[model samples]
Target: MKLKFLFFAISFLTAIHVFSQNTYVFLGSYNKNKEAESIQVFQLDTLNGKLTKITAAKNVINPSYLTVSPNGKYVYACTETKTPNDGNVSSFEFNPENKSLTFLNKQKSGGENPVYVSVHKSGKWLVNANYTEGSVSVHPLLENGKIDSLAQNFQYSDGSINKERQTRSHVHSAVFSPQFDYLFLPDLGADKIRCYGFDETKKQPLTETKNPFTKTDLEAGPRHFTFHPNQKFGYCIEEMAGAISVYQYENGALQKIQRINTHSDKIKEGFESSDIHISPDGKFLYATNRGKENNIAIFSIDENGLLTNIGYQSTLGKHPRIFALDESGKFLIATNVISGNVIVFKRNQITGLLKKVGKEVKMENVSCVQIKKI
Candidate 1:
């Protein structure tokens, strides 16, 4: 009787461990050909930082970027990119039981080269930034998970100092404030971070804020923006300038606090800094740099919301356009677009450093990586 009771207790604990591991990694890629998989889902092994392929969404065209709905029931992607005026935002219904994604519907993205898509926390609004057209499109999401037609389209007609890349407004990303009350658009070509007031209750949910925009350094082409978990600070990764602009946040307004370089002094030219993200604990921040300098810059966040450079980790691949930290902040996965691979790194929570682990996934032109516990 004693032996049987011990066996039952061990089995119960093992079952709980298996059931608690629910994190998933979603990867988006540029589908150069029809036969290629544009979006793939993998189940992450939390113990070893290994990713196992679960499924892939079918018939997705150039899903270069992806965002999962707040409820984890749906996913949306920027599709048909680089297709002239045919860029689109596609929606998919995610079935966790079967671990599959079903195509729902798509809507015209309102501009060209739709590169980034973000869903509001309320799950009622969706926004996408057009990289080539330098515009933003707002859409209302239906209760059934389909995206409605465009509700509002805001276009920018300004350029910065760089005559080549900053010839016109190139909005790289659209990010929502932690409170979900505001939307921030980082325009790489305009050298400005545009702000908009977001109201979920309105038919047209986005309106220009009183302080409409914050200007960065002349050639600091801001690409991606992320807010700290504390909600008091925001960071923008500037692609052209290869620096991160830190700002103090309050009520939809940002005050520049610091501007730090993402690379060492020796590496100056060809700076293509990309993604930026804060850890779940809000203790550290990471930014990825592409181009000739391919690495993830690490920084420690102080109580006053400023960053101190800690160390840098090599991504072990080329052109890491995007990377994501797991919900637990235990693992980070980076997608190397040019090298056609995805590498996983085990994050040291105490020191906030990363060590590469597990075999890399050989994929072609993967542009984005996002992780969620569903």
Candidate 2:
């Protein structure tokens, strides 16, 4: 009777887990590059969704930003450095067995201080943004995780209004349009996003008569951006101006629609915009602000690919530069660089609000967050 009771209890819990579903989350680590505290993986389970520790703490250095191949086979992390010691992107073959990242070759980001990294939709190319040098580059992808070659490196020299930050152009972020037909690069110092025409056969951005699709505000210092999944529009977050600009991008050109403040009427003295991301479902957009105010400005994207402000929420930490929404879209992981922690917040998909879930995962001066699963 005792043996039967124990067996029944185990069976009941196992059945419950099976019904709940399986989910895993991987977190990047940031420290002063002592012994590499590899990217941390967690298990998350909740009514909103399921979560848990998929991989134990494995070792990787300053896995500051993460991107997975569209096919989900390859994972990439940007080292986020300026000096020759660390300015490179590393590729990984994820082993779900132990949640460990197998070593892959490093492709030197010819441009210094590369901050943002992304895999093009076709998985044929990889791109990097040089935050300090104000340059961008594209590299060809190989059948293996290694980069076949870095095909192009383009530098920006334009200067804008802001004297302090605009002393030199800084290409802060680079992203390809949903169709992978255009590349949008936000140069914070230059206060412009230079659009380039994409050519798959040539493997480069072209300067056509219809190209150089330029957009900006009066020294707005555009920092980061995201496109509406529908591909009808795009949005930009400006750090100097502290506002979000909505645009109509159709056919092959872009037209500015709206640019609205991320703050309330009461403007603080020192607030800089950091990151912007559109939710997976295409209903909500989020941008993080840092400085005197650290919060995420939320907006409701309409059917026409325009934006309406929902409001802002304190990220519950300091210097909320970059963040990530879990695959389930139930959690927003906010990385507070100054606070030295990454806090998880439960996101209400319907209401577009975030509430802190638990204590933050301690890190050291983290600059970005990328959430992946096993």
Candidate 3:
């Protein structure tokens, strides 16, 4: 009887391995010239957390931010260039079965240095942020996933402080609300989280009262923002301030509720940070700290939707510019840009801690990480 039970257990484990969908991770590559960069994909085993190379690094300029379409049939990214002289966005149709990517086309983002790109919930609009040009651009979609004509573009002239970093309005990120009614554009240089009512094709500015959106602290320089699954609370990661701020969002406006530092109050030196994400379970929040201190800050979201920094783990690599968690919440991956590698980590859901696993995977100038199911 004992022998038969052991055999059954082994059979179940093997079955689990065979049926579980492969976790796919994409690493954005930069060759330092902002040209000739590429996107690499890896297949992660759900049972053992093993990552296997699916797609080798292919030359595609500044595919920094990528999004797999709603149907998972295509992958889109920012080419971060206009053409001969301006900036634009690129869309690529992907074949998961063969693990190959085909170039679709490019559309002008209407601004320079397009750093952040996101597909709208409706799957009809692709929004982009021009970091250096301090503007926002929107592109329409086509049936074949090719980039269509430019739908709209907006630029704000105001800028914030930190003369060196915030000399001009640098819009770092643009995202949509849960209702798909408004767009959240975080301008690091402008010291504002501007709001716009998004329509089918164009978005208009929201009136102050009938909205749940408002600007943040003038000098905070917000880089990324994530909404609570409930859509009641939100968090914004401030790159310049090295902190995270919580807000209560309703209707279409945002009200600051709390602000917490992502680092320990130790000896002070400037530490630039990047990338912030909430776990799928919505129980934990994580942010990557760059500069001399390359670490991942772990925080717990309270009942009131405020974030309290619990601890931080060193990335075990360099310049962890971006990180992503597996779909099942079993593992996490962080991309080290300057070190030219990607590190895998096992996540403890109970404590919200990260543990290093296996070896540091080699890559080149990896800037972003995106995890999806096979």
Top candidate, metric lDDT: 1
Write down the lDDT that model 1 would get. 0.92
- Please count the clashing residue pairs in each candidate, in the order shown: 0, 11, 12
Who wins the TM-score comparison? 1
lDDT of 2 by residue, 1-374 (tens): 99999999999999986665544455565554646555655666555434445553344556666777776567777764644544677777766656666667678776777778888887888888887778887888888877766788888777887777798888888888888877888888887887777776785644343747466887788888888877888888898888888888864567888888876658765878888888888999988888888899888888877778888889877888788887778888788878877778888899888888765677677667666543
Ranking by TM-score: 1, 3, 2
Provide the TM-score for each candidate, comma-separated. 0.94, 0.86, 0.89
Q: Tell me the TM-score of model 3.
A: 0.89
**Model 1 shows how many backbone clashes?**
0
* Residue 241's lDDT in candidate 2: 88
In order, the Cα lDDT scores of the candidates are 0.92, 0.75, 0.78
To one decimal, what is the Cα RMSD in angstroms of model 3 from the true structure?
5.5
Encode model 3's per-residue lDDT on 133-222: one tens digit a residue: 888887777889987887678787877667877788888888877887777888899778878777764443332235523677767889
- lDDT per residue as tens, model 1, 285-327: 9999888888999999999989999999989889999899988
Candidate 1: RMSD to truth: 4.1
Error of 1 at 177 (Å): 0.7
Off by over 4 Å in 3: 1-20, 32-37, 81-85, 201-213
